[model samples]
Target chain A: MQLRFLRVIFICLMSVAGMVSAAADLEINTPAITALKNSMQQRHNQLAPYYVSGAVGLTRDGQIVLRDANAVPLPQRQAVNALVGAENQDRSALYREIARANQHPEWESEIRSTFAGRWIEKAQPGWWVQDSQGGWKKK
Target chain B: MTKKSCIALAALLLAACVTINIYFPAAAAEKAADKIIDEVWQLKDGEAAGGKGDTGSTDDRPATKPGATK
Candidate 1:
């Protein structure tokens, strides 16, 4: 009878151990990921244009990853020129902002590409994004 | 199985599950890019610059940037 009890205890312990191991394997730091997501949202709000449409992406490590901006065709010459200038300036600022946030300039391009690729992949229908080879595609 | 073997199996499973691919809409991407630029311009200096709306592509003129290549 004691042996039966011992067998039951052993089986219970093994089952508990297996469950613990599986849980550990699937562990994801939810809070850390949430914090990172919040940071990305803040950064996007800061970097995004008020009038123009654009998207920003970040790497898994909370680094600025990719930025996609487009200049809509303008009827006014001044508006067109202004749009062009803004595009260049904003692009530069995006790079600077990412570098500043992560304190890792080297990872800027890599992070950008990672985010860009993801954004493109997840873009909704009728949304526009760029491809890996710098080609345009519809999502 | 040994702990080491278990770990090895887990790593193998992870490796097998890894997937990476690029997805973006050509037309949508162009429009998004254009919208971003326009918004930035407006925000930088508060002014409205009228432009040909993205809705009608009557000209069919291609984008100048290499990234905009269809």
Candidate 2:
């Protein structure tokens, strides 16, 4: 009987959390999520110059892409490509982490879609952003 | 009105609301995304990293966020 009661309590607690997660913003703050955010935040610095120069652009799928490969000199192109790869890996992890943190792993796609739109919406004026239709435009 | 009729009315109302919520919630997701961006980017000064400081190598977590909309 006691075990049954505890199970009921656990279910109720989870339902409450689910409701809260559904209604609110994605502020998980788990160590993994925080680390991912901080990592992205730090990497944003390295990527900032490229963004300003129109070399890299934010995609509609919450990842960055090389918008103008020729923008970077041939010698530095490899380094920029490496940075874009690393940023994308961290971005994928951040989306997955947010979904997992909310206990709804399936929400990852929606979260990523949300972030994609948000990233473009929040992009700087000169920064390139991909539209929902896969078209790139300066924001 | 009779209690039975009142209950029926409430049921209809609830069904309508629930259907709206179950319709994929694109608006809600966008609203939530905006709030997250505000917090994460911490857009200060003008835009994109404290106006004057696009300088890399610093934590860019924003200060506070507004409430989420449904």
Predicted model with the maximum lDDT = 2
TM-score of 1: 0.30
TM-score of each: 0.30, 0.65
lDDT of model 1 at residue B67? 81
Residue B10, candidate 2: C-alpha displacement in angstroms? 16
lDDT of 1 by residue, A24-83 (tens): 321212444323333433343444442224333322322222344334323443543444
Local error of candidate 1 at residue A103 (angstroms) = 2.5
lDDT of 2 at A12: 51
Model 1, span B1-70: residue lDDT tens: 4555545554554443331112222333333333333342232222223333333322344446768745
| Fnat for every candidate | 0.00, 0.21
Candidate 2 pairs with clashing backbones: none
